[model samples]
Target: MNHRGVEFTVAKTAIPGIWQWQFRIGEETKTGKTETKIDLLAIRRVQLRIDRELKAIGQRTGPEPESGGMVAGENA
Candidate 1:
């Protein structure tokens, strides 16, 4: 599964109703499990975690732009 240039995988686990997801970036790998079995939600969660990690290391791509052409934290 490719999302925003990042490749990831969301697979169902042996346990019913449980899903596992994994994604790798460079030499870093992230993994998690969700009970919802919704791939999109799991992917979003993973993306958020990655973003948080990147922000902690000061490697984020800055705030995302909001609607009306305004970026987050920007004063109109």
Candidate 2:
């Protein structure tokens, strides 16, 4: 399933009520298992997880400099 540019898949594990989900963004792949029987809820959970990860990824990379000048925290 695809939501907000994120694509993921959900499958039921052998343990019964466990749902496994995985998604890929750029070169990063994330996977997890949740204790939910509903597919919709699984998707929603993955979407929320995606949102949080994307935010964290953005924060980690930060923004690029426009003028090719010295980057932040760089020594002269």
TM values, all candidates: 0.57, 0.74
Q: Against the true structure, whose lDDT is highest? A: 2
- The residue pairs in collision within model 1 are none
Model 1 whole-model lDDT (C-alpha atoms): 0.74
lDDT of 1 by residue, 4-55 (tens): 5668788878987778888877788888887776767776777776667666
Cα RMSD of predicted structure 1: 7.6
lDDT of 1 at 36: 71
**Each prediction's RMSD to truth:** 7.6, 4.8
| Predicted candidate 2 versus true structure: per-residue lDDT over 1-76, tens digit per residue | 8877988898999987799999999998999999987878887888899999888888999986689788789999
Model 2: what TM-score? Answer: 0.74
Q: Against the correct fold, how does model 1 do in TM-score?
A: 0.57
